[model samples]
Target: MEHPSDRPAGSHEARDLTRTLMRTEFRERRSVTTELAATTVRRPPRSTREIENSLRRRLGLGRLGERLDPTPWLWGWLGPLVVTALAAVMRLVDLNHPTRLIFDETYYVKQAFSLLTLGYEGDWPAEDDDENDAINSRFADGDYSDLVSEADYVVHPQVGKWMIAVGLRLFGADNGAGWRFSAAIVGALSVLLLARTARRLFGSAALGTVAGLLLAIDGVHLTESRTSLLDVFLMFWVLVGFWCVLRDRDASRARLAHRTAPIRAAEESRAFHAAADAAARPAEPDRPAEPDRPAEPERRGRGVGVRWWLVGAGVALGLACGVKWSGIYAVAVFGVLAFAWDLSARRAIGERRWFTTSVVRGGIPAFVALVPTAALTYVASWASWFAHPGAYRRQWAADLRAAGEPVPRPWLPDWLNSWWDYHLAMWDFHNGLRSEHSYEAHPITWILQLRPTSFYWPENEPPPEACGAARCAEAITNLGNPVIWWLAVPALGVLLHTAIKGRDWRAWAILAGYAAMYLPWFAYAHRTVFSFYSVAFVPYVVLCLTFVVGWATGLLRPPPHTDGWLAAGPAASSRRGGWRTDEPTRLARFLTDDGSVRPTPTAWAILLAVVALAVVAAAFWWPLWSAQPVSYDFWRAHMWLPSWI
Candidate 1:
């Protein structure tokens, strides 16, 4: 926590860079130009301690308690790895179960098959009531040409279908593993991605691992990971996009630092040398000429073509959108964040026109990097469809021209026109969908996971029958662990309040991540959406909640309070600023010896009790979450919350 002024100027690069970047941040703009200047600017480089101290002071976390970092060693990685491995094993074990298509897989799988044969989803026989009979006549005979002329209305995007088609192509459409392969892979990858993201955010590999483990063990995520549903793929890409954004943030700042430092030093040195030369020039040639000041350091570009990070951010966002249309939310939110980084950059350099520079240099280039890259990647996702002529919706443009209406746009190629038309149709279908579904979930309940969707149900298949138990045995339910979901409620409240208070940028950043994926759903809740859709942003929610818990536990320290009154108070304050002007703290301090206050062991025990309660709650709901078979009576006993039931 030593100040940068304590360090030599040569080694103060990191803090200087951060300061430079923060200078452009609108929140820090005034401070950039005002608070920091002259001798005070030279300090020993700030470390992890200094960073937290500044944040704690800014966010008023000092008034609450010493902040804590929740990066657990064993719990972080080992626990999460064990949980995730268990999930992976479970998914791979009964992977071929039922040996048949389940739920909406029929439509998606069939469409995928059609895409494989005809390069587009085709119309199915109007009266193929019996699936076996229809497959025998159509697919078995390889008569895919039986598809009708009309395009089928599909609600979701093609990226997911393209994923499905990959497995189908590799394993053939007839096998169980063929349809489920992509889901399993994406699910596992998400676990890995979550772990990495958590590691980065917490600066703890263990915390990252724990986050992944929690996600892996969670019933809903496990089930989706096992299933061939589009939502799982959507979650994977969205998480990947988020991780990339985080990387981009760190990288951009590093680049700004590298580029700005030498330039500043060199400028200072040159100014020194020039002034020395001018002063030494001898007034009226009477005095001996003083030696010129030494040459200044030269600054170098951090290495460039363009900022690769902006490009990376764009590509990640584009890939997210490619998976699900809802990924558009991430693109918009992150785009704003990236621009905010620009503002930080401009203000860091003391540029009066920081906003304008951000708009012209940072903002404009960012759009160029993000927009075109995303658009191209999104379009490229359709390569399979483009390669195959018979894919569903592939020939829409040809169909239009054949109907004798002039092709609407003469400036584009036929395929591009056809693709544009297909997008319009897809958009219409998604927006207009109002189909009633038995498991449709409301958007509001998504946060709490009320009424989780059941992905698999077996008739006459008790856990005993499936697992060979003497009694009802094992099952898999796609419900969240209740303790986690329940705690998230208060966690979310803490996040919202912190964001509004502008206490910590991390809190605000995490909140932005949630809003990107979740807020957009409120508008479409009337459609047949499900609570499972919230999985896309669940990792961020977990991170935000963890951050709050850490802050509450005093993992991160606030800025040192220079308030004179505290030292002047009659009651000695605690070594750490855990006690405030409150009655309880004051009383506790009054009982202290050596002017040092310490909470009793009993108080510490109470805190431990709260943690113990949360763990117990988690264990109680583990069965329901894991889909293990329990008697109906036992299941009812766990339903402490009526809303949960």
Candidate 2:
């Protein structure tokens, strides 16, 4: 400023000139400087850092610069562990108290024990005979000698039973703890998975922990965890698949950034060189020459490829299917989600013909990655049934051939034919299950926890020492916490609006998962369904609710400074200063905020209140969830609605 060249080397003016010169040099020789900057840049642009950080976050690796500081990641895992421990205690405590099969446990528990003893499920004697009760008692007493060998015509797939079989094999299938052990363990682990998944989705460890806490205390999840039910396992695998797909999304974006960065650098370098060459030469009036054209940058091959996380999703989806056929809906939905993500990523990178390129290049690879892996994994889940000739319908093809009946698909192997016929029969059973029951609920009612299924209710039970009344009731009801489930209704509405209007990828992902698990049931409205089935999508419900809570608590927004501006300092102030003061902040604001200041106390207070209410509701309903002895009057007080009765 005071004859800048005359300023001292360390003066502010000299430093400014140095910075400008360095920036110009780097910009001009972009290709040559790109490798140097990538290797040595002390601080990269926010967008670049975000792309790289997203990949690391998905892999459960914290920031690259924070490799030496384990506190952030250490606390991340520790929080989930603490929440999972609480979940485990809630699910595993007094697991053997009931000492009897409850509701659908009458079907799955026995089938699991049979799967452990025989290679497949075995039929129990008719319910009208006393032998059935005797078999139940003997099985409970760890005696299996009287069991029949005939194969059972089970309606569901075998993965869930196999999961139950693991516990039975470990604990001798004599106690409720033995049959329900796997469900309890998987249920607790689901809390862990959901916490970590929410952390990545929302970029907040506190929000993730809150989500885990809610799922841990929700009565429906608690009861399903305590009981041997397929829905819990289905929930676990579906959540796992959802988590995998999210990771794949992060990894794909990071990969695309890395692959395209070089092309950008090359183009910038050619442009700078061409401009310099033109400026250095003087034009001659007599002989005017054409200006030099910048050489085109070499094209890089298609950068995106099949992701391993997608493969993991396919496997998880397959396992989900192995637990229940309803999982196919998720597989179909997520397959489309994967393709859409690829298309959006390509379009974002300014690629021409992105739609065609994504479909031709990314879509085919995704299909190959997901479908084959899922199909193979699903087929592998039936290994026990396929290996055991005593399984039901194992001889259908041979019998048809013996009877001179036309063999459907005669070219197929006998085992495959039999497997196909078995699947058809199972499909028929599912579609034909219109029999009515007291606890049966429509899919519409499931979101509101209406008509919760009664898993256990003891008859002629005397009052225990804890009960003040003469008559007492012991029951397990698959109800949900009213505060959390009811709140999810409005939260979901907000999520839909945000997803559509703002084009929020996170909202869309959460909505896709919710729709996959819930909307498919609408098509089967005639079939008998229960409120407990909603457990399969409970994580999404919690996610939606947590997202709203995050916004309300200002966790999703930058804290305003005392001067009524964002605390993001000069950079964010300059960019956002143009926005009117009353205008709503966008979710993308997180990308620019410094994230230095902690969220205000009000945000923490709101989160604490939500958690506290959820815990209180869980405790008030624990007697019903755990089938504990309570006075008839006390039980009646806990039923908040007539439908709950």
Candidate 3:
């Protein structure tokens, strides 16, 4: 008997596991790529040609053809640690600000308190406006249980509330720290997640660190990181789902390597045995042992391991949906992307049944992972509601059952029925939510952050009385840092070019994330919206910007003759190259080939300039972004544009 250690990597059990993953990967890749391709429209300048050029020239496309050589230190564990530390500092600093309900926190916080007290969100009396306000204000003194009875019609999902409840449980419901815990933790983790993703995609620590820092500083992200809202939670889970899908891709590839070896070995052995038997046939013509024949219905590309990651991805995406219905978009996008990766793997191995096996092996297993896992997670998210019959919409199942409509007995369960009813009610409320308000915003302005939501407004105390200035205003506004956001517009252009021209999968990944979080809001322009919702996409935008900056810096090269020329160029540009006898733009020629900037002298200048600009910008916006008190005139002066006012 063979020892377990001595057993071939392609043994039956191993192959079985690989086959399972292979099947899952095949369909997942197709689904994700097709959806991604559909959502993407190739515009001019950043079209297919641009992608080709970026790959060939900018990022060294040819090198990939030789070997799978990843930069060693750049992609290892160190990048994540650095990124995580920076993210934690940015998110954790002065986290317990405002010390009161802000914006939609008035709704979500109360809902969580109600859930905690009575296991449901009880209706607030419209008549006792002052009483309700008093109760809300005196958060610690209120009888929270008195707020519940029948369920309140909430527009958002239970998952976000549950997350908020966890924080409330830990830090006490009255604390601002409790309310903002969900966003802060999720946002910090997002920085770490994006950092790891960038390192893996770009193979550079500098790039990864830049990505993390940019995300850490983005205004929208910063605000979300300091708030208790469902959007931030939505962002967190969608990112988690994305990461899990990537893991599934890698795991599937590893499985392929393990499963293919035995088939190759067996085929080679059979061929050698047949040739020998043929050579010795003359010695015994009457009766001889039959030559070895290859196994019938040959296996497809070596199987990867079982696709546990896909299942995990499904569960994560499901929880995302439980947080917000919009998460469905992410699920759809990632599902298709996972399958596309599988198809490419099979095609690379020259499998005859590449498409068939990809579909057969990858499709069903992917569904098994995604469909049921999502369904279950979504149901499970409503556990609190299910546990308490008095919770809003919890009795719908009982009401339906009492009506006795002879439904299929096997197809129905109380948990599923209650969850379904709750969703139907939630959907109805979301669709007809057309109420207008003083600050109600349209989604069209979300991209440019035209209409940011103001979260806090306290009674005026004089400058000295509060912090500073006359009538101090402690406000929490959802806005992104201009330096990061303004730069991202151009960065997005670069990333789009890189994705299409260079066929850089990393660029495509960023583009996909940005498109998913931002574009979906555009479809809902008629609905009341706010810039705060854009926080979900801020990390992607910052990441894209940082990546482009890193790319620009990474391509710098030394000039042919003058050392200053190399210093003049970006740090990462090619060190040697010619203009082919003709000059281009003065900026282009000086920067790219001539190498205008050298590390010795130019680095200090650039670093100083950048730091100075950052400091000045930060100072200018300090009063607004950080809730610093200033005169109304001073505040007006800071508002550069009419929209900002």
Candidate 4:
């Protein structure tokens, strides 16, 4: 190469030889750098914040803007209160009409009056006996003094009668207002509860108001509220239990979030320091110190403890059972629901053994919190019966002991034995009831509201002052809003689809509530169940319908890719040559378009139309729902189906 360079400076061979040497040196240096990088230990970026953000998103707490704020107390109570006031007016107005015992009121009202006076349900004469009318007349005239002292073998629990006793104490148990007063108040309060529950469940106050409004005006709910019936009380307690469970879900998630925050922050700080040191000392062998981080918290084991809200739910469900045995179904359903929710929560937080941990650790605490509390509350509801030694079955253990017969559960106390015997007898009575009545409907038809029970229907009278027709009718039929009830049939189907496909927790919870309240009736199809029993689950039906309406109207969430339409202003509309977008928006804008401001047209129209239709339907059926007098032709006109007749 030196000889070639001396011969010619610009020779190709000489230049090539020089380039080869330079390339060899570059290759050696590159190989050394690659080997050093391969031997070095690189620390990954910290993921604590990322993991926490993911968990928050999974728990639906990430979007704080979508949630009602701390002052929700003011807005929350305002809408529900208005709806409850409407319910109160509907239930309390002309409450004492017909001035007679209707349907099962013959049993419950009389028993309530007896409980108020005798601290127990007293016996009543058989229907065939002439004294039945005399006892009823005395009860009607505010005279409860001559009631028989022997304990009545009632089939239901004593708590509902206790509630009725409250009304009797306040209003003097003679009038319908006195007997139905507490039911009315509870029914109205149910509206408040349902509204608030919906608000929390759907994260929208308007939807909650809609749900409450529907419940307030539904004829079946109104009829049950205005009657001295146990179903309304049962419904109230079940709803309270459901609401409490929802509260627990939120509170538990919040607790988990609170517990994990500091751990995440510490991990992030260590990651930042490690990263900074590595960057500053690139020439030296960069060694990241093993951070003195705290042990990773168990995601499922000790994050969220057994919640107090669950205990509240248990107490509420127990009260439901105290009202009626049917309420136990809610306990069973919601117990499973709470556990399932725990599983979902753990899984969402990236727990490895979510199912096993949820069952083994979470299940135990939840059971201890909910089941035992419910059992204790149920037992406590029997306090009045426990106190009244002369009540029915209260002497069963004493009689058995005196007769030298072995008492059932001899290890238990006398009161416990007596209570168990009473429960056995009650269960037997419920299972064996084969009584027939004209209004008795199959459970299958109850959902459709095909054969509504006529709570009150005075005999038609023909007179000059009678309703302006040849024959007059005044009746209170426990019918539902045709639009709402009929619509719920399909809405429930939609809920089932979403629950399975989307695994939406809300849909599953609501479906569980409906199944608990409804599906059990199939087992007792042979028994005389009435359509009025559907009242207990009507709030859920309305909720289902409201959910569907919200989705359809884009109030709950916008349809996929339709957010563009929401963002599109009048200018965009003009640019698109006035091409309309969403149907709801188009219809709403067509009906009430004001050029100056943007409006949630679709949501407003759907809500207003549904509410208006409900109001009109209620008005059309008001005479029948409230037992108000109407002409024969007018009453017949309201019979939309032959089954309704």
Candidate 5:
């Protein structure tokens, strides 16, 4: 905090030691020059922000940015929007081509229509052994006369079905595209959300657009987008929660800094004056018993300011759980993550009692904001089920009392007791399911993409469509891009290392998604699980790959806490330029780096190669992913692994 001032020019030491100091300084500068001749240059430690600015200015980054994109605010948003439009076009085009349900669309989309017609899901009649295809064809034509009014015993909640019902209402269930319009819209929005979230995490528009591109081309995402499935909505809401938590972190930190500024200034001034007074004292013990130095002001706050983002996260996560029970994992991880962030912010601002303070002030409020809100939101998702008494198990408690059976939760009202019983039944169905499936994959192989589910495969039908050859394969397979998914394997490992070694927040943020979406599936390995479930966490896989790409592009060459990254990092969330007027930003820092850091050319080449491979893979597999009729031989060739078949 204090620096030794230059001695008076006429002082004895100034005259005697000046030559020696000059010689030492010359030797240090020469040694620094010699080090610069080699690959790495160690930066001399300095006590102010100006050191970094001076370094960037010397490296030609400060002025170059002024010349190109004098203000990058517009481009940051424009870039992700452009990529999101690409995703929208891909998802929305030809959404009605097949005209029939693919895989679980038979169950979900029909249930959505049933919800629209009746107050709850109604079952379709199964009068004949071989009537499924005939029924699907009839149903696609809007002849739901066979749809029964009885409540169907569905496992998942009603939120996803309600989403599909929106599209069906708008476009009419008779039109085929209406079945999937909701999915297509949510899917495209997921890409935009992922791009925007990545931009917030990494602070670069180019990186955000790259994340969007990867997700857009990813096979499972594209297929799921065009199909009326539940996982994409689950993914979207979880991402919403994740983004909200990030916003909460920034908001809380900014407020903490604002509150503690005076305290920090007092500490710095006290430190500087103390050092000067000590230097001026005579070199003797108990010299005049100098006035007792003042202690630094208390930096601890009553609490971090209002974190409305926690409320947003609560609602988003609740909606996610409304889609699938698996979303509960995010609810857990994000709650602790947000509390930890508050604690970290307090400590960063020099709070000596951060842990206790966070628990009393920050943690309790965050829990109220996130957990209870999500629970209530999830409970509210079943409102329609409660309102419709004919819904499955809606009168379980009343029946049990009439039949003289065990009355579970007797203290609750009969309807709530029935709802609990219904949820228990759903849980039992999910927990005990072990039916064998052709495309089931363990969690280990999800990242590897070894077994992809075939949602539609008409090649082995009674009379397969002919291609240029005797047979053809038109299929919709839920697979990810081989390059990005496979590439994330190593990137995930590196993120683990970085989180441990560098204590980076970005890695922890991403790993939390993997922990929720991917790891919990291992608990259900014995159940009939499809590889398609990996779609819930696919955004994080793209983010993992992008982390390495960030390194390659030199966006992360300097510690993100420094001006190198934060200069533009805050601006990602900041409305216009949130940078303090004197704050410096440099684009060349992303192209090249200061002495201690340099652009990794080899890593950049590898990233470019990865992008090319993904492009090629997308081209080769587009027909199959889109269910276009391709020659049987071509489809077989696209199946790189026999297990994929």
Candidate 6:
């Protein structure tokens, strides 16, 4: 997992990027001698050649590389596949065990069936119905007969419910498996996506696999997968957008390196000739005029070609916003991050107009690709609501116009105006949603697992015969794996240190995602929120811990494959320059000639112990995650903290 900023580390990649293209003549010239007339031949003077090399180094050519990730594609994909398969099994096995609507599933799953039946969210059976002993008792038995004809004033967007509707359509809505199939499928796929993304970000398949493994075993992720809810879908799309952004960075940088290659070669050629001419000018008065300086074609109005990856990211994040409004935070943060990445890339390539060029070449294209694409896709997600005017708030514009009232944003069509109205209403509902609940938790305590939301427990029902104990507890709790979650708190500290002190972009990227998912809730701390919402950032937490663990264990560094001088790390340039990972930029410190950064025995032991403990924690918490029936004493034993109960 090489962190070589591709900013040459006085390493092989640097030598190949610069020296192979232009430095060979400066360092490897030979003077050929002929004995025919006692003639003497000499090479160009040293001072001029040395100056050119100095300029090239100062230009930061050695630090940038064309290739980004060096991992073999096979391992990159295979590891994620294996981890995804494991996650699928865990999510799918006995998924219907609880066989009841739990937590928010009671709202979303039934809403999904409502979408299927009415082409819009419809009200459930009335409160006074004789059969409505519990809210969904009849609906649980597939008796969806009492659905009200009116649209229910649904708070969230339709995209997530549409996803649940896919499952209900496929497996029939009569059972738990049907309600949850899409969530389980999407959740497992998120594991696959995270692993592949980690491989690209860290340049190591092993580290990526470790990230996937942690997410697969997380109690919150596992429980959410086995239930139908919106957040899991929201998490999946945000991850998809994050992965796309990483690809866009690589693609743009690779292009920058290519466009600048010819410029570097031209400059080096000019420098070599000018030096030779100075040495010869004193000896011969007759010399042809120095040719006019060649024009730099690429530098003038440098065009940033179509950024398809940025467009893809916008679309993916738009889908996320379609699931939940909280997704807007990622859209905003990522837009700025993309611009910053472009600014850094241009500066790395020695553009004199780095700032202005970034605006014209990178920033403008980025905004165009991301903003409009995201906005259009977000609006497109409402296609169904547009088709069915009976949907909640779908006819507000029409109703207002018919009553002789002026519509807000009347320039837009009626459907769009109505969508705007619906959004306003949703915003109002979210702002004032302060109704208290037992499961509400503060964002500050989320890192410590200080409070966990209970999704399911047979509060008033008798112990089923299958429990095999007089006092058994069956539950589905949205808690975290204690070993992993607690350790991640310290891991976050490590990430913050690396991001601020070492300027590791990967660390900053992870922190950005973590902040996007977890921090915004603090603004609404007075409102009803649950620990389960933390599932949205579980992937980032896993990456943070995996990144720190891999670094400390030396698993993040790639082994040496070249001679000692260039074998250390990325070009020595990255250390003096502004970017790249901390130790790799300093030339693989403490490196063996043949290999570097091998994990010490003690480091290996600690890593092994951590993995083993996490596995044990997963096993101990599986009953709660999966809603398996356990003896009351067994359930009590797993609650290490009072807040868990």
For every candidate, C-alpha RMSD to the true structure in Å: 14.5, 11.1, 17.7, 7.9, 10.7, 12.7
User: Residue-wise lDDT of candidate 5 within 1-645, one digit each (tens)?
Assistant: 422237666777666677666667766664554344332212222333333233334221342123434334555667679989999998899989777877899889889998988879888867673586678878888888878888888999999999999999999887668999999999999998998888767756667778888999999899999999999899999999999998887666655554555455556556556555544444332223344366756656556556789889999999999999999999999998888777765655446787888898889988988899999999999999999888888877998899999897799999988988888998999999998877888888999999999999753632354556677667888888898898889988887876766566777888888998889999999898989999999999999998767764455433345222112122122221112233334543222222122335564566578778888888888888888877778888888998998
- Prediction 1 TM-score vs. true: 0.71
Clashing pairs in 4: none
- Which parts of model 3 are misplaced by more than 4 Å? 1-83, 128-131, 140-146, 265-299, 400-415, 459-471, 555-623
lDDT of each: 0.61, 0.78, 0.64, 0.76, 0.76, 0.76
Which model, 2 or 6, shows the larger TM-score? 2
Each model's number of backbone clashes?
Answer: 39, 0, 53, 0, 0, 10
List the lowest-lDDT window of 10 residues for candidate 2.
561-570
Descending-TM-score candidate ranking? 2, 4, 6, 5, 3, 1
Best by lDDT: 2
**How does model 2 fare in lDDT?**
0.78
Q: Residue 504 of candidate 1: its Cα lDDT?
A: 44
Give the CA lDDT, 0 to 100, for residue 5 in model 2: 49
Give TM per candidate. Answer: 0.71, 0.83, 0.74, 0.83, 0.81, 0.81
lDDT of 6 by residue, 129-237 (tens): 3444465766668878768768888889889999999999998887888999999999999999998888766666667777898899999899889889999999999
Where model 6 places Cα greater than 4 Å from the true spot, the runs are 1-72, 128-135, 270-301, 461-465, 558-597
The ten-residue window of minimal lDDT in model 4 covers: 560-569
C-alpha displacement of 549 in model 5, angstroms?
A: 1.5
Question: In angstroms, how far off is 305's CA in candidate 3?
Answer: 3.9
Per-residue lDDT of candidate 1, residues 1-645 (tens digit)? 976556776776866766655545644543343344322334333443444334333222232234223323333455456656755775665565545566557677777776666666666755645754465345433455555645566656578888888988887766667878778777777777777676555444433554565666565676776667777877777777667666665555445544455555555555544554454342332223333455644422233126576677677777778778888888888778777755654454344565676687677777787778887888887787687666666776787778887887857887888888878877888888899976678988877777777665545547555444454533444677665666768988876765555344456667778889889998987777888787787777667655554444332222122221111111221222353334333223222211122344543443355445545655675555545566655666765555544
- Which 10 consecutive residues of model 3 have the lowest summed lDDT? 558-567
Cα deviation at 14, candidate 3, in Å, is 68
1-645, model 4: which lDDT tens digit per residue? 355346577788888877676667766665565455444425344465565555566665553334434344455667788999999999999999868777678899999988877888888766663576667778788776657889988998878889998988899877989989999999999999999887766655666888999999898898899999999999999999999988887777666655665565565566556545544443423332333354454444445776899899999999999999999999889889888777766666556687897887667788888888988899999887888978998989988999999987999888888999889988888887789988889988876889988887755353535677767888889999887788789888887765665455677778878988988998998877889999889989988888767655544431111112111111121221122344434323222121111235665676688889988898888889888878888989999899898
